[model samples]
Target chain A: MSRQLIIKGSLRRARFTLDLDLDVDLSKPLGILGATGAGKTTLLRVIAGLERDFSGRVEFCGEVWHDGDHFDRVPTHQRGLGVVFQDGRLLPGRTVESNLAFAQQRARNVNAAVSYEALTEALDLNHLLSEPAEVLSGGERQRVALARALLARPRLLLLDEPLAANDADHRQQLIGYLAEWLPAEGIPLVYVSHAAHELAQLTRQLIVLERGSVTAQGETHVLLEAQSEAIDSVARPVAAVVMSTDVEHSTATLQLDDDVAEAVLPGERVLLQRELTEDSGLGPALQPQSDENEG
Target chain B: MSGDLQAVWLTALLAATTTLLLVPLASPLAWWLARSTSPSRSVIEAVVAMPLVLPPTVLGFYLLVMLNPESAVGSLWIELTGDSLTFSFSGLVIASIIYSLPFMVQPLQAAFRAVPESVLEAAATLGAPPRDRWLNVVLPMAKRGYLTGCVLTFAHTVGEFGVVLMMGGNIPGETRVLSIAIYEHVETLNYDAAHVLALGLLGFSFLSLWLVYRYAGHRFEVVRG
Candidate 1:
């Protein structure tokens, strides 16, 4: 498909100016990585047509969304863009079945997209059909949210921190879903996130945003290794986790090599198991926390 | 005296009709005022909500002008339906809708606006369009706001008199609503009949508000505001 989104210009809004300009050809799911307040959400809003306070051009599939001269501010609903919020905005008034039904109500060509039954099966949303959206867990909501979006059959799909509100297991589930589904559909996705590590399972093409502009944008592996070096750890490989907790013991366990690596516990000397060399002292001075889930 | 059961039925019918007319239009306009970013958004918002700030007479006067048979608006209406809209049931309905606009909009707007943009963007990325977003995403997420707006509009319209009085004269079985009946009785020193109508309006409004709060509190904290 010839689907791609291009946004360029200085988005000046009061003190918050999203000056970063970008043109991304979405053959694969591209991660828009940034720290908090880095305009990741703003960028997604522009593409989704929810935000318009900027002097620039946003073209999708060679169709102009907003070009200063040819200003076509297509309303969000007509833009054919799908979004998944941190909390799944499933209609609580409707059951999970009705939620999908509501989305299917808006599909321009409903026959072109996957049926709700097929999507429910794809995302494993069968049991939650009768349940009210409010009662669903974070992971369940995320799954249903994905199902809702897929049913809409959008031109561009946008995800803003899909795993931020989710627990580790839920995050893992969504990542697994993304890996299996996004490529199959071949629809372009601009995944916005604060942490790059959460995108580990997905494609690693990165657009590292800082302040309001892109500080770095390239292949995931290159950006990760280069960034880890540029950061506190000088020129070292690193693995990062989105979760942080105070372990009771003086040691931290890292999951690797089909087992847990405790401060004292041992694992295979697989070099790939190591991330960046850093003050985190991953190789030593770390004790394994109990309840370290191993796959 | 509404010692006659027919009057009671008439009043209930009028109140319900008024509520039905106000909810849908008010909800979407309210959401737009509270969330949209068009350059002229505030102008449209201010105009939609002007009834809240303007005197009831001003609104009533303008509406009366539009429906008067000798005027251009009345001429257009005469052309379309061979009748004037003023001092009629539809006119009263129109006046009541305007009077109750803010009541419906404020609650729904507050509710829609309260939804975190982050949550919405997530849904958009997932592939929801405007209709799907509102139905599957906005409305369900803002259930408290929607319910609050509906009940408030219904109750407010039920107890309406001012704008209705200005635009719709006391024409029994046509434009004569319960509030008008209560006012008519009070003006003519018919305290006994007035007492019955006033109490009915009062008790029912209280009960409506109470029921809404009771049900909504089970799902949301209406007071945390």
Candidate 2:
């Protein structure tokens, strides 16, 4: 059966509104690229059936997940989804092992490509199994969250910045792993990230969202090349790390390679450059380089 | 002495029964109160908390009136079980459940609220149905809340006086619980007997509160997305 995802919906908040009408083929992995507050996460949430207030229809693979009417909808759990949220919301007060087990026990009985031992080893979660989820570092928590989501054996996978917390090395390693693993498993994926190269590496098709609207949609490499060219023409780009983000204010604290830190506001052009280092087989390393301009 | 012992046993049984029943009964209600965004949520909350502030006699009086053998529910009970609901053991159980509702509900509500919507959403995406999420994700994380609620509800039920007196009327084994027994001891000027039961209750209440504070003091904190 050909995998198809159709979403036609609009969600209204006090300060922002998300309006979308998309019909995407799931033959290849898909990516959603956007800045903070560009409705990327909300779009993922709507697909997962978590956005109850969303008024529209969501159909996946000939199955109606949600209809325009609030009452006529499949709840989140029934959607056969595996979502790795940005924050890695591990079940609190439990060991990492228990968290993974919770997903394994509830997983759909499909012939999953990834085994428990292989997943744990690949994710480097064996040592952290006994550790409480609350005590894990940001990167560690995200890894556990990823492993847990996979254990559920979902038909569709939705990842929102899944590698955003990891260090440069692990981030590259995970991206490579996912790029290989997802296709082998035949699980259709909708990956969301602000980092352009990450999307360029893992996805074939891309959708760029800007202020709750689809500004561009096409092949991932084509769009990224165009965006990179657009950046190359006008601004001096410097490599920086997004140390912390303030979504309410639409700002981020970027730690530059020169050891200088700067706060960036909305409308500032921050380009993520893919640095091909000596260990090139791992994948392109993302270094967020910014061009500051007054909005 | 046997009468006093019977009263103590009855009180324990009543408190146990009320706590057991409230676990299932108050769970959905508390979950709704914790999560519902409807305009009527505040109204439902206030009603659930009415027993907390209202005088026990008032609640007992209404229960007595509503559940009397002549009334609809009471008559239905009479037909079903061939027994009167008012001034009976079952009547006392119903009153205790209402009288101690806030004790059970408030803690459970706090616990359910502590289980973040994000975590529940994550669980749902993992193929857990609603009931599974509630059992595995919600109940385990809300352990302290259940502990606090169960202890408080049991303790509060044991401390009942006005409601039991008004509804059950000191029917020894059927309803004359600890507080009522103490009241009778004081009424009969049996100072020695009253002193024993009152001191026991005072110690019991102190321990329950102490357990709640010592164990459940720190709230369950989840990493938010």
The best candidate in terms of DockQ = 2
lDDT of 1 at B166: 74
> Per-residue lDDT for A163 in model 2?
86
Cα lDDT tens digits for candidate 1, A1-295 = 6667688887788778888578877876788877678888888777777675667888888888787643556666667866777667765455788767666666655554355666787667888788877778876787887777777777777887766655554555667767777777666787876544555457657898887898988898787767654553443332433123322222344554355444421121221223213333443212222223221
Query: iRMS of each prediction in angstroms?
Result: 7.6, 5.5
**Candidate 2 residue lDDT tens string, A172-245:** 78998898899888899999987776887899999999999899989999988876665555444444555665
DockQ for every model comes to 0.22, 0.49
- The TM-score measured for candidate 1 stands at 0.67
Across the candidates, what are chain A's individual TM-scores?
A: 0.76, 0.82
lDDT (tens digit, per residue) of candidate 2 on B1-225: 599899999999999999999999999999999999999999999999999899999999999999999999999999999999888999999999999999999999998987899888888899888888888788888889999999999999999999999999988789899999999999999999999999999999999999999889875544232
**Where is the poorest 10-residue window by lDDT in model 1 chain B?**
B216-225
Which runs of model 1 end up more than 4 angstroms from their true locations?
A1-5, A69-75, A78-82, A103-127, A151-155, A169-177, A193-200, A232-295, B1-17, B23-33, B36-225
Best by lDDT: 2
lDDT of 1 at A36: 72
